[model samples]
Target chain A: MAKVLMKGNEAIGEAAIRAGCRYFFGYPITPQSELPEYMSLHLPKAGGVFLQAESEIAAINMVYGASGSGARVMTGSSTPGIALKQEGISYIAGAQLPCVIVNMMRGGPGLGSIQPAQSDYNQSTRGGGGGDYRLLAYAPASVQEMVDYVQLAFDKADEYRNPVLVVGDGVIGQMMEPVEFRATAASDLPPKDWATTGTGGKRPPNIINSLYLDAEELERHNIHLAEKYNRIKENEQRWESVGLEGAELVIVAYGTTARIAKSAMENLNRQGKKIGLLRLITLWPFPEKGFAELDEATKDLLVVEMSMGQMVDDVRIVNEGKRGVHFVGRSGGVIPSTALVEEKILEILERSE
Target chain B: MVNERTILAGFGGQGVMLMGQLLTQAGMIEGKEVSWLPSYGPEMRGGTANCGVIVQTEPISSPVVEGNATSEIMMNTPSLDKFEKDLVPGGKLLINSSLISKKASRDDVEAYYIPSSDIANELGDTRIANMVMLGAFVELTGAVEPESIFQALESRLGLARAHLMDINKQAFARGAACVKEQRN
Candidate 1:
């Protein structure tokens, strides 16, 4: 394949378009502005709609409207902007719409800096929007994965009839790389009988709404969503582990941090350090089994991240705190140096002895 | 496996970002893994605009350039002052001698002086100074084929600037000739 070189943000836009996503409604934000810009130029040319809404709040609702009408819809934003779209995201999830939201996360607690940060892990995996619903989140590390995951995310979103989040950091959004656009048509997408596409007077019109007047009725809806969530957890927990076979320590990371962690793991391994990496591609499913299957020789686990140890909590729970689990991270757009990560692993090994 | 972590830095109008993009695209043409990351925010508006370009044979992790660069192209004195310390020992440094007055003092690196702006000026367009440096850097590092860079440049400029195409090509050739002449 004659691969094309593209920036991560631009590649994501092209991937979404290739995946049959015709509708893109987004407002501009740092590190992810290229995504909306690309869509604006291409979506209309592809016979799709691209609307730059007045704000992130307005843009996500536009996604809801388009998704309800049976368009493969998407929107993107950085950290603070994504935060603003929470209400609309909740509404989309409540209505059970299949849409993709790309959050190229930046530093945040308030209106944080425009630099990359993974502090949104708790928000993305737990709940960025208010609800009992979970977004099927894909944490891609490389620009190629950033492009590849869109088609998969859209497919998963449609299959589950729910919202999916491609949660990458600023680096994944802004970095440029060579990526092959292996065309993945959201092919085999099931019929959207549930969509609010206008009925041609042959049958009852499909209505998309989340409100239930009766508590029991709402309970039933909640149970249905729960069942699907549990099924996804059981069937769709995706992860990658390297060098866990005979290692004394394993590093748990995802997104850009996972990429750095792999480099550190390899560099240390070359120097005879026993280290491994467990990368979570699907952050929402939280791959508990990947943790359980850790090599027996693994005596300790280190959770390395770009945030101040957000993912470490999950590492502690799954590992049962039975093994020494250490956390090393930096927030506010700082990526931990690979050398520093290697040093931490060596330090952990030394301390345990 | 070959790896080149580079920083092409200069004034905002020096086309440093575009040069980074061209190199990244050239690397892709050769079927190598590559990454280009621009220095964003306030620094972009100031004279010191820079972009990190990484070309490797393996999947790139971190994307951050970290400390020292394996190869560097500095177009102005500020860029030279800022990034000279970050150039790795035994790495290649291409200085735009037209704008930069000081020569690199480090003995650990291979520093090549190219009057890229002067060469582009001779071609009747100083805008191609970035391309001029690109020509010399690629020749010295074997980063990519000269034809690949020409292909990248044409595509990058598109038809909007078709009239300037001849001069740009001339600028690239002159820069490469300058380096070859120096070696001779």
Candidate 2:
């Protein structure tokens, strides 16, 4: 396929169309507004539905309803908007609906700056809304991946029968890069036998609801959800590594920060600093296996994020006390330059030296 | 033959973003990896606007004009004032002489001056100034074959814009001529 230059947000919307996502419901939010805008303009042309709901809450609920009916559906927003959709997200998880949610994250605890951040790491991975559940989330570092992973997220959502998150940031959402989209078949996806499609008197009507009056039944459902999460952990973990062999330390990052970290590591290695990078593509499963077989020569790990040490917590857990996990973060939308990240890596290495 | 990190800055209406897009599009036409990132938020809505573009033979890691930039294009005086310090010494600077009074003060950098807007007006279209500046940039760096830019232009502006193509080509040549005259 011939490459065409595309902005990250537009590419995401187009990739969803290619992946058979015929419905998109979203409200406008900065950094990700272009995504819904793209959908609003293109979805109808593709014979799909695009609705700008009154609020993020209504939009995500609409997604829940559509995905419950077994149509590939999606919704997109930034951090604050994603926060608003949390209640519906939890409901979707409870109902075990297959859907895609994209959060092009911006700085926040409250209405923070409209700059890129990885602050939503905890909100996305650890079931931000409520309950004991995990949503499969992928952090894409490039515009190409922003397109490629949207398709992957849809497939993964159907495979696990759960909500899947494509977590990017303002930088990844706004930047332009050359990309080419290809057809992704949902043919390999498991049959959606649980969809709320009408039975046509062939059998009992399929019911789709999350509310359970019986706590015992809810617990049984939770067990089933937990088993699916474990299967995702086993089969769906994905990551990328650079210069791991005979390296002393590796910087762990995802999304925009991961791209910046790669540049820093490349420059550092050219300067003869024995630094490397391990970028997490799957943020929710946390790619725990990425750290399992670290080179014995590896002495430390650095978790770099555009937040106040959120994913570092997971890195610490995944490291299992094998090595000290140092953290370098720039939060509230301030991105660390490649030089700054390199300085942080150099500082960590110098302290050990 | 260094990978190019470029900063293009001007007023919001001056087509600075489009200029950056054209450059990256030309890069893609040449089968090179490229990235373009624009200034967002209030700054874009305000008079000031800028974009960072990188054209690389290999994958570009960060879209920002990291470690300063190797090339700078200033469309007006304010942009020159802002980005003058950011251009690497021994780098290239293309200035819109039609708008700026003071030149880049740095002596180490090779600066090329063009009255692109004036030239574009002479060619009967004011907007082709961006194409004029692009012509000079391409001349200095050999970033892409000259014809690839026109193909990219059609892809971005559509075939209906074909009418403007000849003037833009003239604007490009005028700007490239200015650079050649300076060398002579």
Candidate 3:
């Protein structure tokens, strides 16, 4: 296929449109502003609706409204802006709506900086908003994956009847890549029988709300979500393990950070260093099984990340403290050097031997 | 397989971003995994434009290329000041002799002070200087097939540009020939 050069943010907008996502509501934010801008220009031309909501909160609710009416909908924001949409995200998850929310993450505790950072790892994987809900999160390392995941996110959301988050760092959102536009029809996805599309006279008015006054009703809802989550754990865990066997150390990373670690690992391996990389493609559901094997393979493990020490904590848990899990990270938008990562790996290998 | 990483930097109009994109697309066409990452900043406000391209046999995990140990930097003056120290040992340094009069200070990194702008001007448009550097990059590093690169460019360029395709092909050919002539 002839690959067309496209920016990561614009590719997401195009992918969503091609995937039968006709309704897009979003507010502008740096590193991700191109997404809404692209949608504003392309959606109307594609015979779709593109609304620039007043705020992140309003944009997410607009997504909620559109998704409720059985339309494939999406909204995008940066870290701080995404934080504002949490209340709405929780509501979407609670109501079991199928929609895609893109968090082109930036450095932050509160508007920290516009540079890309994976500090939102905990916020995204755990609970960014509030509730016993889990967003099926996909971390895209490349622009191609960024585009492909938008379609995948929509499909997964509809299949599970849940809100799926396409989480990416600012770098991923801003970078340009050569990508071939692949088309997939909306009808190719699962049917939306449960959607509140005016009930279609087959049933009465269906309510999509998170509030359940009765404890039993809430419990039932929780159980149902739990069952769905279990299925997600079983069938939805996506990961990539490189050179794990006969390795002395395993490095766990994801997204752009993981790609850098791969280079570092290759350089080290060429020098006769026994090293491997375990990359988590799906950030949510955490890929416990993938980490379990890495823990068993090598006593020395390194968790390199673009965050302070968030994903490193998960490495510690899966290692069960039996293996030495060391963390090497650069926070506040500073990407760790490959040499720095190599130095850490050499240090771990030396210590282990 | 030959693995190469380049950090091209200059002002926004230098077409550094396009060079990175062309190289990445070429790599992809040769059935290699490619990644292109831009310098993290506002692009249009006359800010310094920097971009990284990784062309390799294996999948690229990280797009962020560091200054230290970054081999083969194609820089234009101030960009050389910012990123030259990052070049790896035995890495070639290509400079725009037209715009960047002052050469690289480092002794360890091999420097090629090509009059890139003069060469681009002779070719009619300095915009494809990035493409010229990319042609040089492929010849020097052999990260992917040069034939594959021309093919990718031909197929990937938009229809609006169909009229100007032959000129670009010549530009890339000139770039490759320049490297060969230098070697001879």
Candidate 4:
């Protein structure tokens, strides 16, 4: 495969196509408008279904309807737009349908800014919609990773019969990178025995609906999802560590901040600084074990984010006050520079010394 | 392994970000680790936009470049004003003379102001201006091989855009000539 320069959002759309995702429904939003735009152009050429739904509510519901038919369906939106679709997402989970959702997160509690931000961490992981449901969330920091995770998200969703979320920020959505894409197999997916493709000689007609109206049945469904979640924690935990040997300070971050933190560590290492990076690739099943393992040897721990201490709260919980934990963040869409990280690291070092 | 960092900045439509991407892709084709990060959110479409690209011979430890990159490309007067002091001392600077009237401030830096937009228009397309600047940078700094850059561009152009590859190839040659003429 040859490297092709592709925008992050467009790459997400193309990767879905290559992954045999034939149904797409989305509305327009900033920092991710290119996603729907690209889908509009390529989906038809690939003989796939593309719909410009009337609203995000309609878009997500359309995804639910398509995925019920056993097709790989997807929809993308930004933070605010995703919030509007949460109601439908809850329904999708209640039905236990396989689908893919992408949130190109932007800053804010309410229309804050279009800048990249990690403020949606808690909302994304803790079930933004309703009910006891957990969405497998994959956080990608770069354009190439964005493409990789889109394909992975579909595969995971189908495997678990649950929706998987690809959570990225505007930075990951808007940037460009050289990517070599693998073509998706159109017929390689497992047959959807549960799809409502009409019943002829089948044992029984398959029906997929969220309304159970039975307490015991709903409890069983919730327990089933919980079991799947536990299995995911054991098998799907993904993270990366750089320069962990003899490290004095450990920096924990995900998405764009993680990329910057890695750069700062390299620069610091050149200047004789003992620093390492623990980058979370799966933000939902937060790599709690990675940070919990840092005992007395790790002098300082820093959680870098593009929000007002959203993921930092998780880092602190995992640390359990065993070591000094600090946070460095920038809100409302401003990405912190490497110099700011260096200053923060140096400050921690000074305090430790 | 040397990590070649660059920050290209200009007004919204000056093609500064495109030049950054072109260089990054060229580096990637050469089997180098590369990343292209552009300004997003509020500054992307309307306000000033910039892109940071880091290319290294080894696995890239970090994708972000702190302070200033080893090279800087400015396309407008405002961009020169904003990024003049950010260039690494004695680093390479390429300006679009047709758009950027003011030159970089640091004398320690090697600066060249080419009429990239004018040359591109003469070559029959204004969009190729970024490619011209890309070519000039390769010739002036030898940061990347000129042939590799063209091949990278052609591959990235894809089947949908194979017709425009000739224009890009020509634009690269013109920019390279512009740099050689100055060197002589």
Candidate 5:
């Protein structure tokens, strides 16, 4: 297919349609409002349902109901809106329903700035609601990745029967770029025999519920979820490494921050500084495998983010104090400049020297 | 590595976003990597608006022009005041002389002043000032062909607004001529 220019949010919506997602339930929010708007316009024409629910809470529950009935469903919102859907998300996760959730993050402790941010890293990677469940989260950096990941997210969601998240900051949601929707070979997914698709009196009814009243049964269910999470950790970790061979420092970042760090790395590398980048594509799986394979010459690890320090904790956990871990971040809608990043790296390199 | 990072800034209705989009579209038409990021949210309602556009042969590392802008196109005085310092040393500055009165304070960069609104007015449409600025950028940098921009505009405007194509082309030509005259 020919490349077409599209905004990230609209591209995600189109990709979902191409992935055979037939139901969308979402509320409008800045930065990501375009996604739901795009769906409302085009999904109906594709013989799908696009619904604007009353609240974020209502929207997610609608996704829950739709997914329970064997439909590929999705819901999207910005940070605070995503917070509102957490309880419903936990329920969906516990019920083992396959759905895709998109969170185009904005700055927030509560109703903060409307600009782009990565503050929701912990909330997304670690569960936001009360649950022992885990979500398969993909943090895409570009519009093209957003398109490709949204499709992959659907397939992954269905394969695991768990909700998958395609999380990008406001920039990825708002930016426009050329994207080609490459033809994706359909995955050999397991049949939805577990869905509540009206038994027609020929088979037993399939019940979709997360509630477990029996203490031992709930423990068993928790253990089962833990095993699924372990499997995901083993097989689904995804990351990208650049210039890792004999690097003096490795910068860990994701989403838009990773892109900025890449520019900074390129600039510094041109000036004979040995800097590498490890860009995490899956936030939940945490890409621990990338950390384990870090170049032996890398003496320092700098974690960059839009939030003050969330993903850094994960990096620290994975690094195990082998290298000096550093952090540089900006919050409240301020995107870290390439100059600032370059300065930070120079400072770290000087300190190590 | 023909990387051109441009910041286009103006008031809400000045069509700065459209200018960035057209530049990016033209870049894409030429098979170059490009990205366009707009200043969105409440600021876009009635206040100042801006966008960063990157066009290059290599993959764009960042879509932001916050600190590494190679050029700036300012449609108003405040925009010039705001973004003049963001440009890298030896960068290009294009100002809309019709709306901005002050000269660019920076001496390290190449500055071009075009009364874009006046040129657009002369060309029979005040709204084409952004196109004029875009044309000047294209002529100065040759980042993308003028013909590619025309193709981009035609596809963007579609068949419904096909009649406006000639005027937009004229505005673009006037913009290019303004730059040529200044250089001469």
Candidate 6:
């Protein structure tokens, strides 16, 4: 297949289609509006359903309904829109429905800005909606990764019978890059026997519900969800480490911020500075194993993000104060330049010295 | 090229985004790594529109070229004023002299004053001014081959707009010629 130049948002839509996701219900939002637009134009041609829901809340409920019916389903929105869908997302998670949710994060708190941001890190990783649940969130750094991870998210969601989230900043949604959709191996997923496919009077009708009125039954349900989350945490921690060997400092970043950190690392390394980068691919699992393998010479860890400092807490938690944890971030749609990141790293190294 | 980070800035209708996309597409056709990032949203709706394009030999680290732009293609004066400082020292600056009156303020970077709009007007279409500027960029930087851009154009325009190919090619040649004439 020839590499085609495509926006990240469009690539995500194509990836979902190629992954056999036949149902897309989404409300349009900036930075991510292109994804739904692409779906609207292409999904029907691929023999799929693309419905523009009345609201984000309605869109997510549609996702829950579609996934519960044993269909590969997806929905996308930006930060504020994702907030509106939180209740539906919680319901889907609680019901253990297999679905994919794409959040092209924009600067936020409340309709903050239309530009790219990583402010949704905590919201995505720590469960934005209520309940004892953890979303298997993958934060993709590039357009190519967006394609690959969205496909992976579908498989993972089905395999675990849980909702999977692909979180990226607006840059990943807006930028255009050359991408070739390499073929992914189809996972040997188990049958959706629990799906609410109408029974043909051959067996008991499977009911998809999160409600367990009895306290003991609810506790058992919570325990089952916790065990599934633990298994995910154990098996799905993915990360990439660059130039970590004998490095003085390692920068922890994900999504578009990791790309900036890479550029900064390259520039500083050209100047003979020992800088490394740890890019998180899976944000929910948090990839603590990458930190454990850090070179002993690494004295400081810098958490770079597009938000004020959401991922910094996770870094500190994993680091356990063993290394000097620092944070450098920009909020409200401003991306930190490579030079600014280099300056921060130098400043941190100098202070440590 | 190790890395060529180019910023193409102009008003919304000036085809700056298309120019960036063309460069990126050409780079891709030539089997190089490329990325195009536009300053989107309201700025694209009649405000100053700009896009950052990176064409490089190695894998790109970031798609943004804010503080380390290796080249600036300014189609208007406001674009020149806004993006001139972003170009690194020894970078290349191509100003559309037909629209922008002032010369580049920086001395460290090599500046080319190409009246791209004028050249496109001579070629019978002002919309091809971006192609003219793009041609000058190709001649100046050799980031991607001129032939690669033609292939890119074929793929982008397809069969529907095939009639406009000749003028676009002419504008591109005129742009490269303008740079060659300046160098001589």
lDDT of 5 at A38: 96
Q: What pairs collide in candidate 1?
A: none
Using Cα atoms with residue i matched to residue i, what is each candidate's TM-score against the true structure? 0.95, 0.97, 0.89, 0.91, 0.99, 0.99
Candidate 4 regions exceeding 4 Å error are: A182-191, A292-295, B40-49, B117-131, B153-184
Worst 10 residues of 5 chain A by lDDT: A312-321
Candidate 3: true contacts recovered, fraction: 0.75
Residue B75, model 1: lDDT of 96
Candidate 6: list runs displaced more than 4 Å.
Answer: none
User: In candidate 1, what are the lDDT values of residues A1-353, reduced to their tens digit?
Assistant: 67887888999999999888999999999979999999999999999988889999999999999999888999999888999988888888889999999999988889888888899998898877877888999998888988889889989999998999998888888888778888575477789998887788978989889788899999999999999999999988999988889989999999988988888998888899889999999998999989888988899999998888998888888988678989898889877888789889999999988
Which candidate has the highest lDDT of all? Answer: 5
> How would you encode candidate 2's per-residue C-alpha lDDT over B94-164 as one tens digit per residue?
99999997888999999999998899888888878888899898888877778988888877777777777
Q: Write the per-residue lDDT of candidate 4 for residues A1-353, one digit (tens) a residue.
A: 88777888999999999888998999999988999999999998999989999999999999999999899999999999999999999999888889999999898988778888889999888877889888889998877788888998898888878899998888788877778886654535566788888888757889998886899998898898899889888888788887777789999998988988887888799999999899999987878767655645688888899988888777878877877889998888888887888899999999999
**On residues B16-108, what C-alpha lDDT tens digit does candidate 5 reach at each position?**
999999999999999999999998878635589999999999999988988678999999998998899899999999999999998989899
User: Considering every candidate listed, which one attains the maximal DockQ?
Assistant: 5
Instruction: Check candidate 2 and list the clashing pairs.
Output: none
For model 6, what is the error of residue B131's alpha carbon versus the real structure, in angstroms, after optimal superposition? 1.0
User: By TM-score, how accurate is candidate 6?
Assistant: 0.99
**Candidate 2 at residue A2, lDDT?**
90
**Candidate 5, which segments miss by more than 4 Å at Cα?**
none
Residues B1-184 of candidate 1: C-alpha lDDT, one tens digit per residue: 7689999999898899999999889888877878898877645354578889988888776677766589899999998888888888898999999999898988898889999998888877788899899888887888778887878877887899777778877877887887887767
* Tens digit per residue, CA lDDT, model 2, A1-353: 89989889999999999998999999999889899999999999999999999999999999999998999999999999999999999999999999999999999989898988999989988867878888999998999988989988888888888999999999888888999997665467778999989898898988899898999999999999999999999999999988888888899999888888888998889988888789999987978788875788888898999999998888887788888799998999888888888888888888888
lDDT of 6 by residue, A157-246 (tens): 999999999999889999999888989895799999999898999999899897889999999999999999999999999999999999
Better model by DockQ: candidate 5 vs candidate 6: 5
Candidate 1's clash total is 0
Error of 1 at B113 (Å): 2.1
Q: Which residue runs of candidate 3 sit more than 4 Å off their true CA positions? A: A1-4, A178-190, A199-202, A295-297, B67-75, B119-184
Write one digit per residue (lDDT tens) for candidate 5, span A45-138. 9999999999999999999999999999999999999999999999999999999999999999899989999999999999788979999999
